[model samples]
Target: MQFKSKKVIYQVFTRLFGNTNTTNTPWGTLEENGVGKFSDFSDKALEEIKGLGVTHIWYTGVPHHALVTDYSKYGISADDPDVVKGRAGSPYAVKDYYNVNPDLANDPGKRLEEFQELIARTHRAGLKLLIDIVPNHVARNYEGASTPEGKRPFGADDDVTLVYKRDNDFYYIPDQAFQVPDIPEEFKPLGGDAHPLSDGYFDENPAKWTGNGSRLAKPNFNDWYETVKINYGVRPDGSYDFDTLPQGIDEEDHNVHYQFWQDKDVPGSWEKFRDIAWYWQEMGVDGFRFDMAEMVPVEFWSYLNSHIKAKNPDALLLAEVYNPSLYRDYIKKGKMDYLYDKVELYDSIKHIMQGHGWTDHIPVVQKGLMDIEHHMLHFLENHDEQRIASPDFAGDAEKGKPAMVVSATISTSPTMVYFGQEVGEPGAERAGFGSPTRTSIFDYIGVPQHQRWVNNKKFDGGQLSEKEMALRDFYQRLLNFTVKSEALMGAYEEIHFYNKEHTPGYDHRLLSYVRWSEREKLVVISNFDAERSYDCDLKIPGHIVQNWALEDGTYSVRDALYGEENVLEIKEGVGHIPVKLEPLQSYIYAVGD
Candidate 1:
């Protein structure tokens, strides 16, 4: 079903991976065995997720990685020296569409039954589960009976002459010193085939230097993701060969004889994918997360969205696309119902809370609210990147950073809390992408280990430093407030800008705004800065609010029409009737009661 309002998506990455009991490292062995399996966790874990009042539950990596013979193809070693190293099963690497790794599902044949049971449990407690699906490209170097002797079959290709000059070996360039593998006669490379290091891959940018840049010489799609690129066809051979339509092909008709790796001509590719999706559906999965969504042609989604609507429409679809143009396009095309709003996230947390930008950041937050209401997926962290707790940019992991969890929950979109973020996990980092707190989902860090960490209360009062508690409490209260307030569910607009400009007394620390519905009105004022306060003036609309009550923190309210309207003073570290906000505080007031 389409998400009706904001949701708290409990990221299960850490729960599945970090727990020693439930987790197995390096894809092969489990420390605790059956970590995320329904039988493994105390009902409390999933129950806590439901307690957050989230509408959707997104399980990031539920799919099994296909077992490949070649280690290089999978970007991993099959027989890693350390058994724990096998825990790095990249969830994106889908081996079989239907099979749920035994670790995830106690039983494969009865996987759907267990999943349906879990969904029923969740629904009974009021929630939905969303899974991940990677359709952009299949796992490279994956060998199946369907896979030919040399390379994995991408899709059906008829026109090989355009790519190669020889009979069966035409896909290889002259002096390439590579032999085309024993690809079935019916399935040959479409065009631009090579020794996997062909120049000019996946570039369609109008600006020559702009975009993700050119593909690398190696054809390892998993290595840097830049190793091989899919062609979207905007320019010429160097840019986008799609622009140079062959003589026999109809350029306007993207469906004609083109160099598309997949069946670009077929309108029913989405339908075919639906059948594959149905396999997962049969596995009792309620939804899927689409990977590299922007790369897929618009026509594919046009069919996919409609197909999903007809099938198990209750299934969730989350798209992993970042750019604004691509975001707008996917949402408009009905291709994706939700899009990640990282800009809103980065700006709100960095520029606003870190006190680096404007007090006018509240206006930016207002825009973010508007964006979320229309189409935005809110998230504080995920597996692909570094942990928010990393001591890279902000200082004092224990006491002095910005309030990320508070702002993330309070922000206006459906929220996703990555696996270890709640417990203040500091995960490993990649060279360029930044530090991601998560490790492999199934291996390395399993449930049993997490159980020890949890018992130790490594993130609790004594073990965790003051700053950690602040971050934790911020999230706890934010979640509690989200559940307690109706304003969080209402459509919002900026009633006032907390500050006019970024000046000496601009108060970049405090952000104030309002959200209103047919039944009630709400004023949300937050202090993003650590220890700064300002005499902020909010011009309230006439006759809209006669009386207001603070939903969470204490705060004072005054009016120009009625000077010293309401004197709210902070008492006992909290204001009673008067509105008073503390460090990293958020006040939600109900008006006209």
Candidate 2:
């Protein structure tokens, strides 16, 4: 397979990206706290995001979910507060797979149309669109109000008395009534606000399994009580009820995988999800980001993803899978385009940034996964992770500089940046559902630092401070460079080992590497220490110099990041370069000009 330059993804929470409200009262309603609409992403806003060098925009929370708001006037049912997580609700608890959230549309009846228009706008801005596809679960009170004709809602034709059925969409515990979670005395639905559904009661004769696979009649507070798990041909006794993928089929392409499933006998749930993905593809969505993808059976993914790719070969299929052991299986067999590098790379980088680990482990990790390196998507912040500038995290926005640089240029993988990460958005708001650290994915909240960058929808950094502006500028420069660099897509060789062995003061606090192609070559280095600067002699090995076939002489190298130039001398198949780096600084030097 041919390699491509790094793709940059900008993830924005759909409801909070354009919200200019500053009133962050816990459990506040949409009217009180204000909500961002699809119209909020004006041409100016999208152009600004494009200018930041984003190729794809993952518009999170676009699906209609179970929220505590009343949309009954629009023929949509109201969600009970006792069953909902927060004022805005969890995006993963999808209610209708075919319809978008009405809260995002200026007119509730035109929610789907508004989303379609947003897709057109995104394409016009020279970017692709990605939406969430939560196939592992759905809202507890799942109802598809806007489902197309001839399409039935989930569980509509199911027999609720059985504990498990291959055709049933959900697993039910017979004869048991659903019980609302017991909350602390201080905590109340909607913060003690009075509502008819806030009496700690819900009506369900046969309690279904909770979203996290809890079979309890009454799940605990920590359980995912707001959602219910979907049945996907896996029996409760750990036996497969569906046809398995043929052995040695993991190496085949999606087209072959699609053909393999054409005559297979699968359960109804598999076909239902395939139809759902097809529905979204017809709606002009460029791709999908599957939540908790590991929870679903890999065979089901093979069935669904292969069909999706057959329709649009360029469709991006990303998933949130954490297990390192299953990474290759998911990518090769499940047909996933990319999986989160959370357990290995992200965890290692976080430890290094927090002063708990050393950068020496990074080279070992990169070498270990060289065969599947491009399949691992690198990121510093997402909705689930803590902000880089949060108090519980590094507590300083500048600490992300070296980390982001390394993440973007380390391999041929795609890179992601959460919406407010550029402007140093410290997610410190005390939202209703969870404590402070990560930006609340469940509440009606406003991001302070990102709001400054929004500048009341002007899409300018008019309200940002000098430090914040500088941080965003740095991100823009790094991202734009990564997307256009040819050497980053070619080959990687870790030079840290050679430098540490040859240089007197080279140690674990600094990391260095080289990336090269037939047309271009780059020398990259980063300083992880926040308090110290390093001046060292960086060396390129004789084998690498011979591979490049460079004549021994003096050469000038220019830092692509900061426009600083230095002289490098090549003697007898070896290249020696001098580097001076400040605290948390990085250099990407274009060699042999």
Candidate 3:
């Protein structure tokens, strides 16, 4: 039962998911783009997401961030355009950690109640809730107006005059005043639109360090200037102001880490983030996706995550760590349940999909992380990545089919499905801040392809074309089986190497693997070729057949992806199943005795 409950995270950008607006004006006001509300995620919407076999829904951008929108009526302060990334702000620049985003609420004044209702609705749909918890930084103006009684905002207790201190929440420039980054002549805050707040000046005496750790009074335009770095007791000289973990602690479990920190005194910032996480847990949030986890110290994670596990041992602590070398440190010492597998598996698959690399490199990547495979979460698309259908990417959504199958079933790790990924949403809009290949989290813009599936709040794919519907069905079938199949969480062996050496018609464009458990067995193969189709007598070695205890008999084999019936004939000892793979096609054959 341990591996049977495989996790699939369906990440929905809260402000964009239910927004049906078709007018995608660059740097358009929230009214023009029509931001999706917390209420937009109706019960039917949650059920539709749950229907995709998602165990958790990552409601991204839930926390209140520094947006250019005017919410003064709700007692929320307006953010200067010079500081914000886009009309709608970057989710990582959290303005207030204690409050939910007003843009995602039907009534800005009752935003908290609406989010709580969303948490209830999400749980009622038999799915857990996940939200972003950015501990490394906060908006330049961190106003905790909604912080409950007795809870102070960040920097409230900091000695702002000091450059660094054990109790200080932020690193300061001492006497220097903060100046806005020199605006490049080519770029404007609201796509060159005029706003009273876009005057290219921010008034701040004794400027704090930038979010990316830029210590200058005026951070560069390319830096995360909208946000300021949180001081986790890490000094200017790169020394820890807090107690370090015991030696060899990275090899121990979270419980051991938790016990070690029980008698120790942690930094003030550590306590602040722990309290924020506890506050969300009280509101029924089951987990957090820590933003830019690598930027923060691994020791802080060990402290906070261990405390989190103490309260809810099953809590999912997923982190956005991209460095391969830091992967084990973040997972083991940091006590994170999962880390992004972007650098290894994801990059390799994307290269193959873009017709650049051979599938032979996939096994090499997978083999390197066999010990910690379960902690490496797999995903093809996320908010930061370009859409599969974008011209800059593969220029075809169909290419993701085989890649998605291989990503999901390759190991005993969790899988993430970005919203609009299933329906082939090409992020072609000219959003304000960044380039267009990836969906913009900066400006207020509607997701055109995803809106088709939204279909005027119906939450049904009523407006989807046949091809889009077929693509979604492919995801539906594949993900539904993945979440229920114990074999996906079992032992894995790359059979493509075996097939390439032994079987004819098998080439480098094809990848084959086998996964099995006590109850279920799966033979998975995918074709990465964009123009070539493959027809190969897929073979499992004699040792694997003997391991499965297959006798001289014909076994029932069917494609779990398309329900294509086939037979696995065991002659002598080797098991053979004939497979036909079109360009970018994949098959997960369930072998039954």
Best by lDDT: 3
Error of 3 at 2 (Å): 6.3
* CA lDDT scores, all candidates in order: 0.45, 0.91, 0.91
lDDT of 1 at 294: 76
TM-score of 2: 0.98
Q: After superposition, how far is residue 351 of candidate 2 from its true place, in Å?
A: 0.5
Pairs that clash in candidate 3: none
Candidate 1 vs candidate 2, lDDT winner? 2
Q: List the residue pairs that clash in candidate 2.
A: none
Judge candidate 3 at residue 343 and give its lDDT.
95
- Per-residue lDDT over 74-150 for candidate 3, one digit per residue giving the tens place of the 0 to 100 score: 88888998899988999999989999999998899999999999999999999998999999899998988778898
Q: Clashes in each model (backbone N, CA, C under 3 Å)?
A: 41, 0, 0
The ten-residue window of minimal lDDT in model 3 covers 183-192
Q: Give the TM-score of candidate 1.
A: 0.67
Better of 1 and 2 by TM-score: 2
lDDT digits (tens) for residues 255-287 of candidate 2:
999999999888787888888889989988999
For model 2, the superposed segments whose C-alpha errors exceed 4 Å read 1-3, 185-187
- The residue-level lDDT of candidate 3 at 265 comes to 85
In terms of TM-score, how similar is model 3 to the real structure? 0.98
Better of 2 and 3 by lDDT: 3
- Superposed on all Cα atoms, the candidates' RMSDs to the truth, in angstroms, are 10.7, 1.3, 1.1
